[model samples]
Structures are given as structure tokens and as C-alpha cells.
Target: MAEPILTVKNLSKSYGEQQVLHDINFSLQKGEVMTMLGPSGIGKSTLLRCLNGLEDFQTGELVFEGQTVKADNANWQQLRQKIGMVFQSYDLFPNMTVLQNITLAPVKVQKKSKAEAEQAARQLLKRVQLSDYANSYPRELSGGQKQRIAIARALAMHPDLMLFDEVTASLDPEMVRSVLDLIKELSEQDNMTMIIVTHEMNFARQIADQVLFLDQGTILEQTAGKDFFTNPQTQRAKDFLASMDF
Candidate 1:
């Protein structure tokens, strides 16, 4: 097997005296999609945040591309460039147009030229099927369009791994499929490495190469996507699936 693109070993986190995550371990290979499934407050979102350095872990280690991630390390900024994350909220700058929003990070953080950034932004917009909305403001677009723009902004950085935190949770029911479809397309066509924290079981089963069942911070089961859904090995996982059905 090839070396994993990302590895988490004995990972744990806490908020004050309350421990939120326990000794979590997993690895993600290049071009693989892993979906985290769990009930609310299971620390799924927190795990994704920790992976991209948005949250600090109190113990364990995160090895990305073979280098350890240190919260206080000066290279954090550079390391973050390789990990792009999208949140449930669109997080778009309302003051900026779609094109400007997509190009901002590349121009400022990456120091790419305005023309270069804009060119990349346009191509990303087309990929997300929002090329016609380049000049539109966030307020002028639908929930799905805004989310797609946010995704394009993340892709503008050309990240090696993408983390999605319940990205469809905030969208309207009608809009959810479009965004999910876009992500599925990216995984299939671009072979993007992704860690998605989602409650959409069917969608997860469709795109994920692996499925991780998390409960109260610990990983209860980690297995191939199909097997995890069809033949869950743990009672906790079985109960979760049963609850989702009922």
C-alpha cells in the first residue's frame, strides 16, 4: 500500500476540563474519500477542524505529507495551504462578488497575480456550474450557488486534501442534491482527497472509499464503505443505522 497522505495517531482534544475527543487514529490515502458518520455532538466537526489546524489538539499527532503538525509551529500557515476546508455556513464575504471572493485568497495569501487568480477562479466557477454568476454578489445568489462559490474559493488554493464539515446541513432540502452532486463529481473526476463529516448516509455510501463510525469522540468502527453500511461489526454502529432508519 502507498503511504497515506494524512495520518492521525492517538489524537485527542478537550475544551477546558471536558474531553471532547479520545485517542482517535485513522489514515487517508491520496485520492481517497473518507466519510465520518455519527450522531450529534460526536466531535465529527471538531476532528475535521483539528486536521486543518483550525482547532488545537491537546495530545496525539497529525502527520500530513510525513511532517508533524504543531499548533505553535511557524509552518502552520504553509501547512494550511495544502488543506482546504469548507464549513456548513457559506462563509463568503458579502461585500465581495463571487469572482472576487474566489480570487481573494489566491491573490493575497498566495501572492498570485490578479489575472492569474481571476483565471483560476473562472475555471473553478465553471466546474461548480456557476460560471454565469461570477460577477453576482452573495446576496443575489441562491443557497446552493453561494455554497458552490465557497467550494470554488477553497479549490482556488489547490489543496492536497479537502475537509468538509456538514456542508449540506445549512442548505435547503432542494438545494442539497446539487451541492452534493458537485462534490461527488469532484471526487470522481478530479480524484480529490476528502474527509467529509456528513449525516447524509446515502451520499456518504456513494462517494466514500471508507466509513468511520464515531461515537462520543471515539471511533467505534472503521471499515470499507460498503461493508460498514451493509455489515456493521459493532452494536453501536448497528444501533446508529437502525436509528437513522427509524
Candidate 2:
């Protein structure tokens, strides 16, 4: 399938002597969305962090864009440029304006001209429905608006893969849908390649092309999105679905 944009083979991780992930294996094709779903503290977030190099894995390998990636390898920094990650926290620089936040990476790391970066930043702001907030500070925006700007900052880098770690988890109930809608649009309209870790089950069923149902650091089921919610193959998955309010 076009050589799979990202592949994780026998991937595992641990904190001190306690293992958190056990032989996790999956592959994501270009423009596909894979949602990592499980109960709290089940290593879903850790796996996502490993993929983006925010955390290190103790064993196995990640292949991105046809190259095998090791956590400490020199190629990792270069590969990170193509992998955009948005966290639960809105990590915008408080000192920088929204426009400045989006433009900084492109200008500094990408070596783009300031005017070019600003233009791209403005376009991203428009896409996220925050064009008017370009000159505003992070402190002035609502949680949702700040999150959108964080997403725009990632997009300004022009990533090939997007990693979202419960981006809506920290938002107010009223603000959740807008952020989720934006992500859904990226999947439906822009055809973005993404690996998402989310507790929003309904959104997971709607947006996923594949679902990895994990439990206690291991995958209990990896199935197509449509079949998973309707007819889960594993008992763990069925119990998980049954327990959720949705």
C-alpha cells in the first residue's frame, strides 16, 4: 500500500523496570487515519509519543518514509520535521503573537523567508477559522482557539504525518466539537495521514480508517473502523464498547 508511510515493528517501551508497551506492531498507509483506543493509562499516549520522538522506546523500530528509525539516530531530527504533533495542552509561546508562533519554526528551522512564512501562517490561520486572531496573544484566546493556533503552527511546518494526543481532552465540553471537527475535516477534505490517541469514542468511530484496541500495553484487536464498533472480534474490545456511555 504505497510502502506504508509509517511502520512500527515489535515496538516496546518501559519506565525504569516497569514495561508499558509490549511488542506493539502496526503500519499506517499514506493519508490513512489510525486511532489508538483504550482505557486510561493503557500506553496509548506513550506509543504516540514514541512515534514522534517525544519519548524513547527500548526495543523495536519505526520505519518512516521508507527509512528505519532508531530513537537516537541522526536521521530522527530530520524526520521529525515531517511529523507534526499536537498535544492536549495548548503549548503556544505566551510571549509570541499567534502569527509569530506559527511562523517561527518555518523561518528558523525551515529557513523560509519571514514574508513567506507569514503568508503561510496567515493562510493556516484562515483554514483554522482564526484569521482575526493572528495578531492576538495566546493569553487572549480561549482554550479551543489556542489549540487551533497550536495546530496551525504544526501545519506551517508542512508535515507529512500528524500525531494527535487527546487534543480535545483538555477542552471544555462546548469547545470539543470545533477541535474535533477541524481534525475530521483534515481527514475528509485534506486527506491527512494521522495517528490519533483519543478517548472520544464517537469521534473515534467516525474518523478512524483503522482502530487499534489496546489493553494493558498490548493490542487486543486491530480491525477496520466500521467493523470494530459494530462487531468487535475480541471480548476485551466488546467489554470496552459496552462499558462506554456512547
Cα miss at 65, model 2 (Å)? 0.8
Candidate 1 lDDT by residue in tens digits, 113-188: 9999999899998899999999999999999888889999999999999999999998999999999999999899
Clashing pairs in 2: none
Per-residue lDDT for 1-246 in model 2, tens only? 479999999999999999999999999999999999889899999999899888898899989999888667566777878999999997999999999999999999889999999999989999999999989999999999988899889989999999999999999999999899999999999899999999899999999999999999999999976788999988888888888879
RMSD to the hidden true structure, all candidates: 1.1, 1.0
How does residue 93 of candidate 1 score in lDDT?
Answer: 98
